[model samples]
Target: MSLAVALEVTPLPLRHPLPTPPPHHVGQPPTAFHNPWPSFHQHSWLDALLTSRRNRDFKPVPPRDQLVKIVRPEWGNGQDGLKATWIGHASFLIETPKQNNNEGGGRGVRILFDPVFSDRTSPVSWAGPKRYTPTPCTLAEVPEVDVVVISHDHYDHMDAETLQPLYERRKGKINFLVPLGNAVRLHGMGIAMEDVTQLDWWEGVQVTVPTAGSVKLTCTPSQHFSGRALWDRMSTLWSSWVLECVNTSTTATAPGPASPLRLFFSGDTGYRYVPSEATEDTVPVCPAFGEIGEEYRPFDLSLLPIGLYSPRHFMSPVHCTPEDAVCLHRDLRSKRSIGMHYGTVRGGISQYFEDVTEPPRRFREACETAGMVWGKELALLNVAETVVVRLDLPRLADLDLEHVRSSKHTKYFGIILDLFDASLKKTLERLRLNTNSFSATLCPSLSLLAQMRKSSAK
Candidate 1:
């Protein structure tokens, strides 16, 4: 009988229901595009930050081990979980830390963030730009998920190809945590709204799944517009999320388990410096910076954008540069951040759209120049990258610089360079040897982009 008692002893904490946030207004969708050239407005700060055509290529930095299943245990069952894999362009398959069965805290579930899996972030594949490199991980390889957090309805962040398929396979079983006005679109795609939990800024739901354990998903504010088409911009809400699972002692000081473990997935956004003027009565504005800024909290893990930002005048207002991404980390007050949405893809859809195609090394340098700790502040991760941050410590300016600088992103700009060269070569071949008109007109734009890519590579 004593042996049996000893064998039954455990340290797994009792996980309880999450404490919900106060009620918030779920405002109507942003239904129109008033910023005629949002990119120009966004790029106003990229004077020295912009990468030139002289450098464009980047090295790939796949994680030492691509599997998070192996890394979660080190994060431990106490207050940490396994690390996660970041598929490029804002899609992540985060592995929650190990959980104790029936306790409501250890449920280690798979999650998808702003899943835009399609080749193009456009309504029609024909017009939008294609992904320069293949997604770090494909939709099929991912497993049945516990949650899907869609920040907004932008084509790049909330793609049809990605969402429709995930919904088809995991809709009923998966809890979809999305923003307001997005339910109409999700339902339009055949998902039941009941299965979907939509929220405005500062709102959240605590999910306790039999297999996945207990987790709290919270919607936070971002300073960017939303839309799948021109007419529908802002009609749908956009947001970032904080997914956390806390409390584990088998027993602790408090009656319930503690909830502090967190992962932040920033959907798609420019930096928060300019403060988006919400003309449409958007909910979720930061009270600290906006009308209600005091209520915001810093994120733990930030999945920030870092690509498609060329022609600064056009892309600034809509996309963040690598340097700007560093600033966002400071803005969000994240503990440890991972960089995305920069080099793996090309972006900037129109006067309205934005993307960051530049590498973050230079941006990191720029941030450091401005007194922000570069390697210590944020970690710029690449396709197929993973990191395990021990939740036990508070690290700000002392991260592994060697680890960060050593991490390399895939070089997608080679294709751009090759394409640019190929087109120029092809055009030259078709033209007469003495002809200058066609050659003169085409070379400048191609040359500038080429040089810019080249400079950025260095």
Candidate 2:
């Protein structure tokens, strides 16, 4: 059998495993789940370096001996609510809600998102971007997880070392959901494929929790390409995950559904389709802008990329600019967003710019210019910080929306046709959505994203 099919076919043991009640949701994990497949194909390290333009200046700072005493997770506060702890980058340990202590579970559910516990994000453990911060939650301190979700196969997004240890520690107690092609990588890494669940984009996996209800984790689309090496760029898929919790009965139409708690984990993207930029003329399939095939609504909370986009010439297509991040925050319709992938790791050599430093300051100015509102006071996080999302809280809409760039022409109108064509034709496509829609003379040069951010971080 081909790798995709073999990897996708879960063994009967996993196809229908013991239905233990997941601890957190609004009520499910938060588990020792691991992706068990690995790819045997060898990626060329030489090509990987040449194509990558990562910043290598920032090195890993030694961990704080802050004395973390390992202990079992403590069930917190209450249900009809939620909490998420950002462990840096797209990594977050979400606190799942438990109906009550009556269930035979522990301190709620602690689910880790994109937990890359590896020292570096490269094929080799030592060669990639050195982390700026030590992982905040240690393996011992981490709460028992019930489900693990792998959005894609990119190194920074998915790591072997980390998941391996997790699988060994948790065993059958954990389960995993990964993208279609990622199982190959997990299998090569020696992880058993039986317990792994692979889903295509827009597909979902239902976790049946007893009192806590169920959460249908949906894998959604993000505007980014995927590949760990040149030969396989876009070979596998990249996506953002939408984790929604349902408190109502599994069959109930409307069980007074509390705000469906959701968190969007943006794998890696360059903010392409903003409802604001999409127009009838530009979008082929659904020319009427906001009506794109499936215009996914804004997530309740979001973790967005805000860095690695200096020297616009090359980075524009792959990484998002600070301003673009602002625009994405708007496009995704997220209530509160935490900036990530900026300060966590910086190992790409192309990242060497004369003026910029780590934690690129331009994003702050961009948010300010866009009048972005986040956190308790509604301000962008200057560094690694945490914020709680409240559906019924006061927001910072005090920006001069009239003067924001969205109020002006961003030149995205030009690509509406191309994006539409790609969507309509249903053939696979890749386009670098730069600020400049591309002049007829320069359209050929468009694919050479080496010319991305020469101008600004903002």
Candidate 3:
């Protein structure tokens, strides 16, 4: 389908369950979109420092052989394949599906997320949290990175040292997508402004490749604070990312039918925090994941944060525990989930109940609690190990198309109602504020979608 037709049929202003804040707040910093959760409490640093000092028995780092390995060629074999390699910390090299030889030998896109190759995750090299495990692959060893996504401005997530060498190697072809208010830092790092795309929560952009298809990058909201220095808290936005690759190929020789594969990357994030009286012992969790799943559920795969949630008192508001990560997996309706953000370095103020290496163990327990098999549906990968996800697009084609479309429309209508927090549907009974208004435009686009669906179904 042509871009024009897709635009005509596409739902206007994509509906979101969580409230979205504007990219910029004129005089002051922007607030967390929907929840009134404070990004960071002012007096928690002392508690965090004291907590860190109390943890005298740090776990020994994993063996070097177990932590990192040389990159094999098959990891880059992207045609009609999905693969992911965790390089340590929060960095990952993701290879998205590509069209087969029938589609002119299309190659899948390579996406790098929160790549930190430096020895330490701090403003200066000599101080801060150093990597307990070695990186899986060096910058020189990584396959050509088509896109790099920075979740926030934190040192571990956005490393200038890594970016410098990567830029020199890619020779300016790499595209960096960062959160809002981070362009300046990237610019200071010597990357061109045109090469960087900064986004706010809910904003998105589409990149089309001639041989393959189009990948939609959406900056979704996350419950996290950002600041490299003390004074700049919450000045820049932080986010989780959702990537939707819409395959456009059609032919007998293609790997599969043209179906869209959706993936979600939970950047450094905390579980939802519901506001309550200070006297309350526990912070209530929010329904943010439910809202995310409502729109982008049944993801082909998801990378969820499963570490750094020790000492619940200080970390609960800003980080997700293993159980919380499992819940997030359900909320996103992910087909497969791999736990990340642990086993590389320490995070947050208090020593967790479990050892640093205990995230996977806790994750397994949580999976059982959630009634999912550990290796089958959910996974906790070893550093440098690769996981391949094979998608059956043809099966998607056989689904009821119109029914799916109507469900989407209905979802948006419900979102509109939720936004108002009132029984406006009855009051504005005659208003064209529901799905009926867009029926004409939406129906035609499904015809094109049907063709893609049919191919995948084959």
Provide the overall lDDT of each model, using Cα atoms, as 2-decimal numbers: 0.51, 0.47, 0.62
Instruction: Give the per-residue lDDT digits (tens) of candidate 1, residues 1-458.
Output: 01110001112222222224222222223343222222223232243244332234433334434312111211112334445566767777776665665434444656778776688777787877666556655677665576788887877777767777887776456767788768888888778877677676656777665655656677766556676654664566666676766434343433344435566676766542333333211212122112111123334466777665544434444566665565455444454567776544555532123323225655665455544344444555446555544332222211222222212322110001122234333322332232223221111122332343334334
User: Where does candidate 3 have its weakest 10-residue lDDT segment?
Assistant: 408-417
Off by over 4 Å in 1: 1-82, 103-107, 250-256, 272-298, 349-357, 370-376, 392-458
Candidate achieving higher lDDT, 2 or 3 = 3
Q: Please give the RMSD of candidate 1 to the true structure.
A: 16.6
Per-model clash counts, in order, read 56, 44, 6
Report the number of the highest-lDDT candidate.
3
Candidate 2 per-residue lDDT over residues 1-458, each given as its tens digit: 11111112222212212233321111123112211111011224663465454543433333434211122222222322344555556666665444342144433344567878766888886566666555655665665565677777778778888788877766655667776667777777666787677765456776653323345566655555556775776566556676665434222342344445566666676543222232211321111111111244435556677777644434444566555555455444444556666556654543454223333466566555443332311233322233333332122111111111112322101001121222312211112134123311121111132223222222
Q: Candidate 2, TM-score vs. the true structure?
A: 0.62
Please give each candidate's TM-score: 0.63, 0.62, 0.74
RMSD to the hidden true structure, all candidates: 16.6, 14.5, 12.5
Candidate 1's TM-score: 0.63
Worst 10 residues of 1 by lDDT: 1-10
